[model samples]
Every structure is written in structure tokens, then in C-alpha cells.
Target: MRILQIHNFYKQAGGEDTVFEQEAQLLRAHGHTVEQLTFSNNDVTSTKAKLQAALGVVYNPQSAGIISQSIKRFKPDVVHVHNFFPLVSPGVFWVCRKYKVPVVMTLHNYRLLCPSAVLYYDGRVQLENVQQTFPIKPILQGVYRGSKIETASVVLATGVHKLLGTWREKVSKFIALTPGAADLFQNSSLRLRPEQLSIKPNFTADPGLGAATREAYFLYLGRLTEEKGIRTLLKAHSIKPFPLKIIGTGPLQALVEEYAAKNPLVEYLGFRPREEAMEQLKRARALIFPSEWLETFGMTAVEAFATGTPVIASNIGGGAYIVQHQQNGLHFSPADAQELASQVGLLEQLPDLAKKLGQHARQSYEQHYTPEANYARLLQIYGQAIGATEKPASATVAAEAGL
Candidate 1:
């Protein structure tokens, strides 16, 4: 099958960018023809460019034209979009409709439902905008990038599209990374129909099982951001000092450095290459995923599972959805430092139980997150999208065309 993949990359590369590239590679490796059209936030630099970008957030005619040209040339079986926020815009969907091509979009974040895209900001998970059509609160509070103008632009874009039924009508199918995420979007202001959404978790190539003898320290792998529960992890470590190794860099790098300086057991290893990170995961007693927000999917946790290391994740969002408490891994209340500490102590105390969990974690990876498994599911979703025959609502199509 021939596929055209579209994405707008953030200034700093992220998991979504990685996933976009990985899925394209996965499809190509399976003998499918794949072509990519990408945009980068790094290009939105000067004041004039930023202003123009904000103006085009709702609909970019140039981006639509580009898509139209690509579709005409490539004649792809389907167009799969990963991210289009602030640049590619919802206009591409309309272009696909014009060309009578199927469009498959992966919901890697909550950009359609929340301005911040994570349903989190101002030190917590903010759900006030989830059910609101205009999301006035997030706009007023400047929930996106700490700029009210930027937040309003995002809200305006999504709100306009929602009003036009762009999300519900233009796209052939929406892929949510987990069941929790699917449920969230189903209940959100987007009001996506059950049939329009499909659950497909992200997958990683297996790193093989870890060594039989594990290391003493626990591992925390991901960005050192507050939403990632870095503070919670630090507080939990303070509650009960344990040999903890943190890997990644973000806004809270200084805080992590400070804690590592004071605590003898806490070792903060700055961003390491993927191979080295996987090596640490393979040897650790357990991986700690303490994200406070509703993550679309916890890729690091899945990586840990792939390395045969059990994860002790906070009982919220993707962490809760992915890690089965006391089965494949353990779960503690989100942001509960004491409980997180207790779970850490339990792993230290019960070496045999941790081993069993690790074994199960490896099994879980084999069952759900392998490349072969993901390839099958992806093909199924593509087939469904290609086979969809429902005509888009005429009024909605006309409304979008007027934009």
C-alpha cells in the first residue's frame, strides 16, 4: 500500500516526532510504499512569522494546497497525519476530502480538546476545558505556552473546526493510543463517534530481556518536567532514600541537579543515547513512571517492559492503563509521595516478587508492544479507513470549504 504521512514537528523533538518516524519505518520495513511531508516549528522564528502562524492556526490554505499537490502526484492509498497543530492546521483534512482520499489521524495528544494538549498546566491536570466548546478558561489563563495570545489561537482553531464538524466528518478514522485516551476524547467536546475512534497503543522494538541479576537502584526515564511527576519522584525519594537513577533533561534540570547533589543515593544522568538508556533499564530493579497528567501513552514504561523490568507507575492516565498493579507491575496514587515510597520499599524488600513482576512485564511486552503485533493492528486500521464509505455531512463540508 502507498501511504502519505504528514507531521508538524515541534522546535524540540519529542515522542510524537519519534513515533511518526518509527511508524513510517515500520510500514516501509513491511514492504509498504511511504512518503512524508513534514513542517517544523523551528521555522516559526521571527515576530512576523509567529503572527502569520497564529493567523493560520485555524486553517492554512498554503498547507492545504501542498497536500492537494502531493495527493495528486503521489496517489497514495491513504493519508496518515500524526500532528498538524499551529502549522498544517485542519485544512489538510478538507484537502483530502476534496481529492476523495481517506485520512487517518493519530491522536498523539489532546490538542483538539485542550489548549495545552496534555490536559495539564499550572502545576496540575486542568480539565476545565475538556467539556467547553470555546475553552474560555484555558484561554483566559493562558494555559498554552504561558501566553494568552498563543492559547487563544489554539482554542480558536480547535473551536472553529469543532463548530464546522471538521473533526467528526473530514477524517476517516482517529487512532487513540490507549483505551483511556479513547474514552477521554469520546467524552470531550470533540464528541467523536465510537466508530470513528480506534485504540492502538504505541510499540517499540524489543530490546531483549535484561540480565538475571538486577541492579539495586530504581530507574526514572523521561523528561524532567513537573507534569512528568519529577517533583513527586524526588519527594518520594526524600521520604525513603533509595538508590535512584534519573535519565532525561527538561525545564526542571536544575532542581534534579540540586537533589542529586544533596542525596547520596540519587544519581542524575543527563540525557543519554537510546542504547545506554536501554542498558540502564535492563539492569534496574524497576522503572518508576510518576507522570501526573493524562499521558496519551507511556513509551518509556513500555520500553522498560521490553527490557524485562517491571514498572511502578502512578495510578493515573496511561500509567494506570499500561501497568497492571501487582501483576506485571505496581501502581500508586498519583502525586502521593508516601505511597510511591512505600511501593519502592516493597520492591526492595521482596526481591522474588520483583523478579516475578519483571518476568510478567517481559511477557506483556511480547504480547502487546512488539513490532509484529503493532504492524497487524496498523494494517487493520488502514484497511478500515480505506473501506469507509460514509459520505461526509454536506453542510460540514461546505462550511470547511468556505474557510
Candidate 2:
């Protein structure tokens, strides 16, 4: 079977990119023909380029044409679109629709429904534009640098897309990372055909880095953004008994550095290579994912699972999906330093419990998230989508011949 995968990569590599590459590899390894139609937002270095991308934050005609041309060339059985935000708009889906192809779009984040993508506005998760109690407009007042144009663009695009039936018309299947995410849209006015929405989480790569070993210090990976609960983690480290080490870089790097300066317990490693990052996860006592928003899936947490490392993740939205609250790993309140500190303390006090959790986390990784397991799942989904489309083609041809 031939499959065409479409994606518009963000400036920095994220989980969506990982998913796209992994899925393509799985398909090719399984002997299916896969072609990627990728567009990048990274090359926009100049002011003019940035302006163009900002304009494309709403829509891009050039990207739409590129996607249409690719569909015409590839003639794939199924077009699995992973990401199409800012650069390649939802209009790309229409390219596949024009050629009468099945489109399976994986909503890796809440980009369609929420402006900020993670549904995080200001310092907290904003369910809507206004503060429920105070009537403060966190949505209008942009988080960083305060660009009203950029903020309004995101907010408007999300609103306009939902209002115009963009997701419903373009997506043949809406692949969600978890059941909770699938239900989030279902409970809302957002409607896809009942069976079209399915929960399919991200798969782990065969880390040439191998399994992680237990260490004395807990590791905090991923972007050091505010919504990631970085401040909370730092505050927790300042209070907690055990040592904490942070990796990665983001806007909150300065704030994190400030915390590191005052506190001896917290160590800042800055941004490291993937190999080095994996090694850090391997040696760490546990991986801490204190994200305050509905992360579609915790890629770093799963990456830790691959290394047999237990994760202490926030108990909210998609973060809850990865760490099962003490069975596989532990969960802490999203932005509560005290709660996070207590969880960290529990692990420090109970080595046996930590070991047990780590072992189960690895088992979970092996059973469901491993490359082999994921490949099998990928093949099944591919077969289903391909077979469903092929049936109609054959039937139509047969009827035309009056056979």
C-alpha cells in the first residue's frame, strides 16, 4: 500500500515531528510505500519571511498548492496528515479531498480548538478567554513579548476553523492520543463521525542509547517554558530534600537560571544533544514532567519509559495518560510546588517503591509503546484505512463494467 504523510514542522522540533518520523519508519519497515510531503517553518529567518509565516498563521496559498501537487504526484491510498499549523493550513487537507483520498489527521495538540495550542494562557490553563472570577483578559494580553497581532491570529484562526467546519470536512479520521482528548471534542459541538475518532498514542524509537540506569538526582527534560510548570519544579527543588537537575531550553531559561543561582539542590544543564538527553534520562532517579496544560502526549515521559525510568508527571489532561498515578509512575498537582515536593520526597524515602515503579514503567513501554508493538499497531490502522478506500474503488470500477 502507498501512503502519503503530510506535515508542517514548527520552528523547533517537537513531539509531532517525532510521531511523523516514527510512523513513516514503521510503515516502511512493514514494507508499505510511504512518501512524506513536509514543509518547514524554520527557514523563515528574515523579517519578511517571518511576516509571510505570520500571514500563513491564518492561511498559505503556496503551501496549499504544494500539498495539492504532492497528492497528484503520490496518488496514495491514505494521506496521514500529522501537523498543518501556521504554515500548511487545514487547506492542505482539501488537496487530498480533491483527489478523493482518505485523510487521517492526528490532533497532536489542541491547535484546532484552542489558540495557545496547549490551552494555557497567562500562567494558568485558561478554559476560556476571560477569567471566571476576576474577568481578566489573559487571552488578549499575550504571554511573551506581547504581540497582539500574533495572539489575535492564533485565537481567530482557531475560532474561524471550528466555525467554518474545517476539521469536520477535511478529516476522514481524527486520531487522538488518549480517550480523554477524544472525549473533550465529543462533549463539545465539535463533531467527527463516531467511529472516525480513535485514540492512538505516540510510539518509542529503538534508542541506540539503550536502557537508563537509576541515579541519585531526578531529571527534568523538555522545554523550560512557564506552562511546563518550570517555576513550580524549581520551587519544589528548593524545598525538596533530594537534588534535581534540569535539561532543555526555552523562554523561561532566565527564570530557571535565576532559581538555579539561589538554590544548591537544582542543577541547570541547559540544552543537550538527544544522545546526551537520553543518557541523562537513563541515569536519573526519575523524569519530572510538571506541565500545567493538556499536553497531547508526554513524549519525554515515554522516552524515559524506554529507559526504564519512572516519571513523576502532572495529573492533568494528557500528562495523566502517561503516568498512571503510582502504578507505573507517580503524579503531582500541575503547578503545586508543595505537592510535587511531597511526591519527590516519597520517591527519595522509598527506593523499593521507585524501583518497582521503574520496572512497571519499562514493562508498560515494552507492552504498548515499543517500536515493534507500535509497528504492528501502525500496520493494522494502515490496513484498515487503505482497505476501506480500496473497496469503494474496486466496486465502482466493477459496476462501471456491469460485472
Best by lDDT: 1
Write model 1 residue lDDT over 1-403, tens digit each, in one string: 9999999999888999989999999999999999999999999999998888888999998788888999999999999999998789999999998888989999999999988888887888887778888988888888788999999999899999999999988888899998888888889888776667888899998888998989899999999888999999999999899999999999999999999999999999999999999999999999999999999999999999998899999999999999999989999999999999999999999999999999999999999999999999898888777767345334433322211
Give the range where candidate 2 is weakest over 10 consecutive residues by summed lDDT: 129-138
RMSD values for the candidates in order, in angstroms, are 4.4, 5.6
Residue 287's lDDT in candidate 2: 91
Error of 1 at 3 (Å): 0.5
Model 2 residue runs over 4 Å out of place are: 45-59, 129-139, 143-145, 208-213, 386-403
Indicate the worst ten consecutive residues by lDDT in candidate 1. Answer: 394-403
lDDT of 2 by residue, 1-403 (tens): 8998989898788778978998888888879899998888787789998888778765688888888788778788888988887788767766676787888888888766655667677677766632121112534576423776676676665556666676666566677777777776555445554545666778888563334346779999989887898888888876765688889899899998888888787789998988889988888888999999878778888888888889999998777987898887998878989999999989888888888888888888888788787776555555555544545334433222111
